[model samples]
Target: MEQIFGGGIIWTIFIGFIAGLLARALKPGNDKLSFLWTIVLGVGGALLAWFVGSTLGWYKPGEPAGFIASVVGAIVLLAIYAAMRKKK
Candidate 1:
């Protein structure tokens, strides 16, 4: 089952949670993201990492990034979100 999904959906969700938490912690200013948004942020981050990492030959498709990469991805997204919000 795990092989079917590579690392499985559960692993993605768990990594997303951890990445999101780390992102929130690292980001400056008070947190404004909701619970759902937090999850989205994390998952989005993971997706971003996968995309970038794969493009850079850091990882293969269906391969999940390590915790540090996930967190870094999350932080980048968070920064983008903040910038967009600031412009509004």
Candidate 2:
């Protein structure tokens, strides 16, 4: 778990929160996410980026995703979330 997270759980949560804020700021449009949800989004994005990067050999084992990549991943997730919400 520590290897996957690239740090201890607390560190991951801190990074995730920061990434989430950046992602929300960079993405255009309104996102009705609470504080907790933002953290979840960021963490999820980081995981997503790590998985994709690993598959593409951009990241070796136990390597954490870059900040930019994390933000990008969050943006992609946010877009998907928005699209899904729009459909409802």
Candidate 3:
């Protein structure tokens, strides 16, 4: 199986956090997530990228996207979250 930044979940979380932060910085408007939530956003974004990328043949099984793709995934997720919250 392909690996990203090596084995285990720690590296995945680390990359996800960084990707999430970058995504927040790259996206416009305000985000009210706390530190923990931010981390969740990042990790979730990375996972999303992995799933979607793999489905689209953009990534191999067990292989996650790089920084850019991760950030893009985070941005999309953030936007969706924001929109859903706004409607509530």
- Highest-lDDT candidate: 2
**Please, what are the lDDT tens digits per residue for candidate 3 over residues 1-88?**
1254334677766776787888889889898777777778877776677778888899876665666776888899999998999998
Please provide, for model 2 over 17-80, each residue's C-alpha lDDT reduced to its tens digit, 9 standing for 90 to 100.
8889999999999897999999999988898898899999999988888878888898999999
Predictions in order: lDDT: 0.76, 0.88, 0.76
Q: Between which residue pairs do clashes occur in model 2?
A: none
What TM-score quantifies how close candidate 2 is to the native fold? Answer: 0.93
CA error at residue 80 for candidate 2, angstroms: 0.4
Q: What are the TM-scores, per candidate, against the unseen true structure?
A: 0.83, 0.93, 0.84
Backbone collision tally, model 1: 0
Q: What is the C-alpha RMSD of each candidate to the true structure, in Å?
A: 2.8, 1.2, 2.3
Model 1: per-residue Cα lDDT over 6-84, one tens digit each: 4767876666777798899998977788777887788887777777888899887667666777678889998988888
lDDT, model 3, position 6: 39
- Give every collision pair in model 1: none
